[model samples]
Target: MSWTSFYLIVAGLLAFTMLLVCWPWLRRRNSMVQDSLTNVQIVKQRLEELEREASEGVISEHDRRQASDELKLALVDETSLQKEGSRTGVLPLSVGAIAALLVGIIVYFNVNQLDKVARVQHAIDALPRLSEQLAAGKSEQFNTEDVRDLALAIRQRLRGSPEDARGWMFLGRLWMSLGQDVQAIEAIERALAIDPQSTATRISYAQALMVTGEAAKFQRAQEVLQGLLSENPENDNLALMMAVVSAQLGDADTTRQYYEQIKNKLPENNDMLTQLAGRLAELENQIQDVPQGSELDTTATPGFTIEVSIAEELKSKLPEQGFLIVFAQDANSDNRMPAAVVKMPLQNFPVKVTLTTDNAMLPSYSLAQLEQARLVARISTDADVAPSPGDLEGELNAKVVAGQTSSHTIIISKERK
Candidate 1:
């Protein structure tokens, strides 16, 4: 290609890119012009409302009828004037023509430039399999070459339409999956900045921060979440996530507080309530396994291992008082013998136990009992945490059958699409 030819090609490409970039603004402006025509629509709606009110005796029938008659006459007059104006010359015709011509020319040039860039992009090949791999969360699904092509596509698309919230979100996630934390943050942050009110953007941003362990930035994410919680306190998903994040941060008190708030705000059958219970159990387990002070030895096991898994259905039913500490004991003792204390978090959960067999002196519990032990939750308010609710006794018993994986499906809440 000669210099002029090369310049023309470049110009065409640039025009194409610009046209694509301006597409959103174009659509919005068009919508705005159309929306402006709805003033008449509002008047029509008001006319109908006045008629309804007059029929229902909510307003003076005379006033309603007069208002409706006036509205009908004004609307008809307006429509007739609009039609007349459309037919006859209504403004500075010469200036309006010039302005319209200029706008049309500008739009045409931008559109042409946009078309060239799109064509150039089309010439750049990509693999269909790459999209599948990306969907499957496989970073390795695309090699460096494939990544380059995909990356090019991403950059061009972003350049062409940076304000597209979904595109930004997707690119951010892709960067995260590649362990490109900084780039992911930038992309996701840009998306949020563009559409600050979008809940999906906020969630995706929070997830990116969590995955990257930007501990310092966590407070910002938490603030965003808290703001959202304040807006919709009964939002089960938000409430559950709030509790989970609290638990993860080693704030059991805060975690429990969030859970309680969620429970109070939500209905009796909120599904996220179930997740909150599981997270509560995990927090309880961690709290129990702690050695108190920070000074610890890595070399020694605490002589035993404790595994606690709760059945899904039972999770939501777990009270805030915490898990029931179960243990095999002398069936007749005043304080039942603590054969092996089983700390189970009530969430109507199935559990697993791994006792420390290192103490040869201690008698071993058979795997048969361990495996066969059924789900038993304890919150003996009189004997449970506090603020007793039941007249039940000190202990409850259940068995878990061995070699079985049992789970309860708990469907808590549903919202229509």
Candidate 2:
């Protein structure tokens, strides 16, 4: 249920519970007052009987007077007892009321679980907007804490809402952008399971599989894309992914076929078309360089490099298996989104890694376009691109110019609190 709905339900329940708890007290008070009034009327009726009997010579005047005095004493005793009963009840009722309030407060926070429920609900509510920011590559505006919260919130929501196909797909893409291939594959697989025929989910799943670096998985991605292309032969996205997969599989002819298909569909003089043309030329050059049976090395220059190390004292805190994230962001920007990022397995200290234009989270913003930037290297236990609690991190500042090589070393000296 949504947080707002949950809260409304809880509030209704609380109101009912409180009413129930106080009902006995309220009823007891009214009943006590009525009982006192009834007793007084009964005493008056007895006194009238005594006076009538004495007047009719049924009893002596002395007897009537004595009986009247006895009745008065009984009335005094009853009144005193009722007053004492009320006074005695005050402490217990007060204690019970206090106890009920405390229990309600505790249950609201625990059994009702308002804190986490409200947190995830808010996150789920904000997901569409957050996804827009991510697509626009406005991650620099987000902090590590926000990203971590979002990830956790998504996980929390997905647990109760497994049928949310679109949410799963978005999560899969988010993981892909964060370079968490395993998680990306898992989330996309869930999305595919929910909607097997969704073209978007299929494409995302295929891309995630390709990033796994396993020959078998890469082949699976190729098969998926190949099927997609059979259904929509002119699909540019499918063709492009097919080309990449083909090149990876050492199928030069198939790669050329897909690339040409994409090229034929694009308009001339478009920037994307020009970029594709340049990529095709590079592919051609590589194909010519390799022998008939040999594969071309597809490695390209990265945008920058970060040398990372951990302090000696913090080494013991590192886990055997985790992720190391190296990312760069514009120096003057207020946003925390990295212009480019790379994720690697946690390793020994003093590791060197590169960030490339290809690592740019958003197509519009890349490390190569920045004039000055700050690089952060973090060791995270959860494979999170963001620096969350318990993660070790460090940062270095550097001057950057598009197409110019940049390098810097950073030491992971402090743990995220």
Candidate 3:
């Protein structure tokens, strides 16, 4: 159920319960007033009886007079007692009602965790709309914070409902849009595990895997694409991806076959067709008469070249055996997972390093997919890739265009500890 609906239901029940709690006291007060009136009537009746007996000569004058006096006194005492009881009852009932209300409010707030519940509810309500927008290729149209909130909500939900395959898929795409390729891969992989036969899931998984710039991942992506294409040769998207993967793997024959199928399947006026034609031309120009090698050719790939150095003041703090880790990550994404990273000895300080799909943590993400990125260089006391206490670090942010080269410099001047 929607959080808002559940909250409202609980609120309604609480109101009903409060009224029930106070209802008995309210009825008791009215009953007490009714009882007082009945007692007064009985007193009047008793006095009338006394007067009637005196008139009828059934009792002596002194006896009748004494009985009337006693009855009057009793009535006065009863009235006083009733008044005291009413006042005493009112004070306790009022205080009890107030205390009950206060307690209920406290319980409601604590039980609901109101602030957190509201935030999670907002996220759940927004995720479907955000997914629709993203699927429409309008992700760029959303505010960055909105995107972040949507992702957060999905994660919150997945925590409780981990078996939701579609949710994982959405989360995967959302991460990709945010330039969190590693997380995207992790999410997509989860979805793939849940539903291995889903073509869409497999395709997304392959795409993410291929960007890691790792040879093994690239081969896996190629295998996935080939498997899909074998089922339907005219699947244009599948064929196109196969062509790209084959090209990356330096399999000219396979690449040409898939490229030809893609062209044949797409209409002549299709924009993608034109784009594919140009890519095919570029591939032909680059691969003519070239022999395939065990190592992929990354020279033609667009990426970044980073220059790293230790600040003069901090240089002495660097340990002789420390490892210098350099990496680039999406600048716009909150995720710290690197798109590309390399490690070297601290002796390589003041070194220039190239970052591309070749250095990707996964084959599915590389500098090629980023329009902007942050460059980081760290000197770790141990060879650990993760930054640890006392690690010296530096970073610089830069704007980059995919398929192009950019340069940036970072100086290690700050200690993580």
Error of model 2, residue 34, in angstroms: 4.2
Candidate 3, poorest ten consecutive residues by summed lDDT: 282-291
Which one is best on TM-score? 2
Question: Which candidate number would show the highest lDDT if scored against the true structure?
Answer: 3
Error of 2 at 94 (Å): 1.8
The TM-score obtained by model 1 is 0.33
90 in model 1: Cα distance from truth in Å?
77
lDDT by residue for model 3 (127-150), tens: 888879978999778986687778
lDDT of each: 0.55, 0.76, 0.77
Give TM per candidate: 0.33, 0.51, 0.47
Model 2 Cα lDDT, one tens digit per residue, 24-84:
8879878999999999999999999999999999999999999999999999999999889
Q: Residue 366 CA error for candidate 1 (Å)?
A: 36
Query: What would the TM-score be for candidate 3 when compared with the true structure?
Result: 0.47
